[model samples]
Target: MIEKQSLPSAPILIESIRSIGYSFETAIADLIDNSISAKATRIDILSIPNEEPYIIIFDNGNGMNKVELEEAMRLGSKNPNEVREENDLGRFGLGLKSASLSQCRNLTVVSKKDGKLSAFSWNLDYVIERNSWSILEYSEEEIMQLENIELFKDVETGTYVLLKKFDKIQASTLEINKTITEKMSSTIDHLALVFHRYLDDGVEIYVNNRKIESIDPFLTKNKATQAKRTQEIKIGESIIKVKPYILPHYNKLSEDDLKKVGGKEDLRKNQGFYIYRNKRLIIWGTWFRLSRQDELSKLARVMVEIPNSLDDVWGIDIKKSTANIPDIIKKNLYSCIEESVFTSKEVYRYRGRKENNSEKYNYVWDRIKTRDGYEYRINRDLPQIQLLSKNFDKDVLIEFERLLKNIEKSFPTNTVYLDVADGKLKNDSEMSAEEIDELIMAFEDSLNKCQELGLNVIEFYEQIIKTEPYCNNEKLKELMKEKIKKYE
Candidate 1:
């Protein structure tokens, strides 16, 4: 038999995964994941930036014991290739170690369970000094030092991770703290929505003493009264329930409103889909490959919730803040999301008519291409009398005969034309001067009626005459001259 030799202890490679690669946002998100998994109903995140910036993540959840605390600090010790329970929030179990290390050189976890308090800490400098992986157990005196910390007082049972010597935070000064607070305020607002049901309890998440407010991108609170139709669909075995909401038109939204129902305005950067894994938000913004189209840009936020077991399907990384939706789910999601977009677009179009008077002229109005010039198209087959003159106005119709008479002398062209098949104008017939005046008066009266009905007759007529000039007949000048003299 060959002699079996034991291999030397493998040196702990210190350079492989340093704690500086992860962004501050991703690191904080990871810490929150642990809290959520612990069944924390309330979570408080506190950051004090100064000469020595520090971060504290406190949660009201089942705390860990001494042994569990020690094991939790050992990197890569998580049981591999093992199936987790349905309620388990951990997938790879590297979140706490990796996320904590990525943000600070020193990490301390304090917890109370079974009527006992225990704590564990990992000091990177100390590990590098000894060139080994070791967890420092908190002494009775050290625990006393932490007990005085405000966040730890009055907590029945929970775990708190204190990140100090924040060498990884991009901004560590007091000035930077202001900016971080602003950014975190927006981030927490979105988080509240991701785990709304959990946060709505008496437990509150305070950022700098201000409670976080949930901003529902779907406008579910106001949607009941404003939505025209609401539908829900149960998809696949996951029972992924999709709630389709059709929002009110743009006009219905308050003039001072910053959010529009079913609109993507709420999903950009700080406001999009808040992906939650086991009641913790892991991602924000649109999932890769899914973009906000113009029609859907206003209503793009669609929150997707998955149990921790589906972490592999979502490509959840160790940071627990970014994820990629699998192709299987994306296939079904595309159709549902598309339908929601189409519904919103139709509602916008229909409600626009009911709310705005200008919508009625959408078809006939010549959208002036330039201040000095205009381009017009008569899409309808109706006879049109477009006036390219600068003086076109509603009051011009009051002196319609006078204006036509002036045109007969100055331009000597038929200011009006007859569309033999169209109802816009009457057919021209041989008549005495008196009869021509009556006809002109009747036509002018009809146009004034259109104006009263809020129709843009001037714009409509401008388009028609520009497309089909009134001088279709060569004798149109003579007819105009006769009508002008008779009117005078």
Candidate 2:
């Protein structure tokens, strides 16, 4: 078989590139990726909204010379299989052109390097007129005359991308200026989250001269946020880092706290795995079918960090908007999913309670979940049980444990549910003076028994006050505290 010379029609290919599934926000983010990879500490995005609108992204990154600029302006500058630097964010090298022209008809790029400047542009009208893949190169004087080219006047080295003639956006709307303004406004939030780590580490991004604050989705700084230990998964020669974070219970979070990672709406929408390639978020709010998104796990968010070397293994797409998790990777992440999901459930289990931690609260009953179903068992750690266990012998203790288990198994769940549904669940009556005196006498007897068994009387006294029935009766609690002071 001989290879024949067959080329894609320039006009058709250009239009095809414009339809490569890029939204306005995603297109701007794609261009910013190039800036970050260039080691630029600061990036500025400027939008000019008018009848013939244009947008400019200027970065102080290591700008290219004439030849490098020419190559970068090409459709496919670098092969995907080629090895890139550890920090390089480019995958198919089609981001700059494809992302820019996807929203506009004309794309121009001007760069400053080594005290010299160069500019080049791809005009869709000219390409369609000539029916050839061609670019317009500019002289020093012509480059100086370009709109917003003065942004690089004092820069040591940087690159400027200018997008003009938003034909598609104009065709879709009567008010082109307002639409572009809104699009840029939404892009700010996307950039804030996608590059949050970078921004936290001192890299600054400005939109229309306003500095954007990083939006930390994990709330890593919040004291209440539970950050599980980082786990590493080794594949071939690289290591994929995984760290799971459980957000605070909704009631525990303040309004300002919610605003940081967007609002309550974003909490559920941004749950699940957040895949990042070299500190830049690629995809998020998905479990990749490893797990389902449920209300119990809404607070769970896992951060999976992979390097560019493993790009092939992850199947990262051209837009970097989605990924495919391999079976091996999914298996390794099973433990993390189980842990984060369990913790998130616990948050709901104790919600609206005085204390969130089970160990801290001395509840009379324990609600335990098992594979079969939920079990409503009496709490065996109560002061009454401890006092009785200290006095009972081995055979007596065995009989007592069996009795407790039988009571737990015989819980009236259906009766309670029906009562609750019918609004007939009665509240306990207030304890009278006689009842308080009787409970005090019973507790004093237990305290005497604990002392006779050589147990710490003060310990038993403290537990008696914290335990229920006695804890609920304020009169009995005050009398017990007065009597227990002598034991202390």
- Write candidate 2's Cα lDDT for 141-242 as tens digits: 999898888889768999999999999999999999999998998899899999999999999999989998998889988888888889999998999999
| Least accurate 10 contiguous residues by lDDT in model 2 | 352-361
Candidate 1, 1-488: lDDT as tens digits = 89998643323453445543666666666676678667777788877766565778888888887777777777765764567666666767677877777766888898877767788888888887776676788886788786225565677788888887756444455565665666566667555655554565544666656677654445556542223222233334443433344444545555423352323343234323446565555565563555454443343455556766566667777666568877766766666555555444444544554354442333432323333222333333332323222235667655764655464346311222112112455544445567646544644554555556566765544333322222233343344444344223
User: Candidate 2 — what's its lDDT?
Assistant: 0.87
Best by lDDT: 2
Q: How many clashing pairs does model 1 include?
A: 9
| Alpha-carbon RMSD to native, per candidate | 13.6, 8.0
Q: Which segments of model 2 are wrong by more than 4 Å?
A: 1-3, 355-361, 364-381, 389-488
lDDT of each: 0.57, 0.87
Candidate 2: the clashing residue pairs are: none
Q: Provide the lDDT at 39 for model 2.
A: 90
